[model samples]
Target: MIDSHNHTSFSEDCKIPLNEMIESAISKGIKHYTITDHLDLDYQDKRFTFSLDHQARREAIFKAQAFYKPKINIYYGLECGVQPHIIKEAEAVIQKEQFDFVIASMHTTHKKDLYTQAFYHGLKPLEAYKAYINEFAWCCEVMNEFSVVGHLDIVKRYDLSLNEVNLEDVKDEICQLLKIIIEKGKGIEINTSGFNDIFQHAFPHPTILKWYKELGGSIITLGSDAHFPEKIAQHYEEALNQIESCGFENITVFKHMKPFEIPISDVRASLKLDIL
Candidate 1:
């Protein structure tokens, strides 16, 4: 199976060593996946840059690929935390690093860390959710570099009870965002992180996936969004089932910054046979 988004020691919030993550993927029978560490440039927190030493990170990936070759295919990728003010800095990193995949995501809105409770302090639940969706749309409209937009509805991760919010309330903005992604040949990932949380849904939600497919957006990727060895490819079979239910017959994978496809039937069969 293909798990296109993941993390390791390269990301500040995660501490698993590079080789350990690779071993974990092998254990899960995930032959194809990306080591997409975080690169949240110009982050509000001064202490946590989420940036990596490009040369060192690349060397580690190369060594792992050589050691694990034929057994596993490790693709080097990056998860860029994008914001309005830091677009240029994000672009510079993309230009410098030749990643197999680039996942643009918004971890904060209005320079406020979404993970912190402070981000939702003043606004009502729906208002807070709307603000995040708006900020994500703005980034999608402006930023031109990236293979896919990661976790398009990540705000739901923090707000476990966002029942007050409705997709129709932000339908225009959401549709525009999806259009831009498809127009630019970019895709979206179905992050399985939420399955481990109380929310029990993919990051973008299955309804959102249906909307994207209805709008003719064909490129969809699957990721466990795993931050640790144990979490690697977590709940992936269910996530793929969710995607298939959304009318996607195939999932996109990346290599050398180019796109490829794998039939969902094969992936699903792998899950049923416990061969992946």
Candidate 2:
């Protein structure tokens, strides 16, 4: 199976060594995986400020490619926060690097915005949810270099109270953002990490996936978004089932900065065995 999003020690929040993570994934029969380390440039929370130094991280990624490829296909990538002020910097980094995949994410509402309780203080639950969606829409409109938009409904991870913000109520706005993402020819990731959290469902929600599919969205990637070795390939069976139910035939994988289409049926067959 292909795990399209992941992180390692290169990401400040995830301190696991790269070699160890890759070894665990290989043992799990995950033939393809991408290390999309965090690259949020202006997060306000110092505690969550675990991101790599751009240049050093890039060099390390490239250098490790030779070693990692022989064992399993390793693709270098970045999970960049798409805040308005940092768009230029994010774009420059993508253009300069030979990254196999770029995941545009909405981690912060703005350059100073952080996904903390303080940020949601005082606002009604629905209002706070709307604020996050509004920022996400704006990010999708402006960030064009990304190959896939990561974790469309990540704000729910922070505040489970916001999960009450039904997709139907915001369908028009969410669809507007999806339209821009489609126009830009970027895929949307079904981040499975949500299952590991309080929300207890994959990201973008089933209803949102149905909406995107109905809207003519074809490119979708599935990721465990694993931060630790144990989390690698976590809930992949469920993710694949979810994708198939959504009418998607294949999931996109990356190598040498290009996409490879893998049939969902083949992935299903592979999973039945103890070894990949």
Candidate 3:
């Protein structure tokens, strides 16, 4: 199986060394792994800076690829924390770096980090959802240097109570965003992080995946979004099942920013995993 999104010590939020994370993926039988560490430029949290050591990260990735050789295929990637205002800043980074894959993620709105409660302060659940989805759509529209949208509905992750936020109420907003993504020729990743959270689903619920497919957004990638060793390629069986159920027969991977498709059956066969 291919794990398209992951973080290592290069990311501000993760301290695990790249080699450890790589060994974990290798142990899990992942044939292709991409190291997409966080590069959230101008992150709101003053306490932390999400800037990446690009050269250092690339060297480590190359070292891992060479060492694991024949055993695993490692690709150097970046997950930029995109916002409408930092379009040029984000693009500049992409242009300067020789990355294999780039994922545009919206971790903040108006420079406020989403993981903090301040982002969800006073607004009602639906209002927050609309605002978050709209901001993400705007980012995808204005930004030109990304391979796919990472965890499109990641705002839902913060709504752990699960009672306040309702994605159905904001379907139109999501549909419009999906159209923007497809129109831009970009894709979305089925971020499986939610499965380990309160959502019990992927970052974007299955319904969103179905809508994406219906809207002709065919570039779908699967990522565990793992930070630690145990999390690599986690819940892939359910992720694949969700993709198949959503009318996606194939999943996408990237190399030098170009996408390639692998049939879902082949991906399933690669891991010898099946849905129960």
lDDT, candidate 1, 73-172, per-residue tens: 9999999999999998888888788789999998888888877645777888778877877788788778877889998888766765564577787677
lDDT of 3 by residue, 151-179 (tens): 98888677654335566888899999999
lDDT of each residue in 139-164, candidate 2, tens digit only: 77877778888889887777778888
Flag regions of model 2 displaced more than 4 Å. 110-114
lDDT of 3 at 18: 90
Residue 230 lDDT in candidate 2? 90
Clash count per candidate: 0, 1, 0
Q: Pairs clashing in candidate 3?
A: none
- What is the RMSD of candidate 2? 1.9
lDDT ranking from best candidate downward:
3, 1, 2
Q: In candidate 1, residue 18 scores what lDDT?
A: 88
TM-score of 1: 0.95
Number of clashing residue pairs, candidate 2:
1
lDDT of every model, 2 decimals = 0.84, 0.80, 0.86
Q: After superposition, how far is residue 43 of candidate 3 from its true place, in Å?
A: 0.5
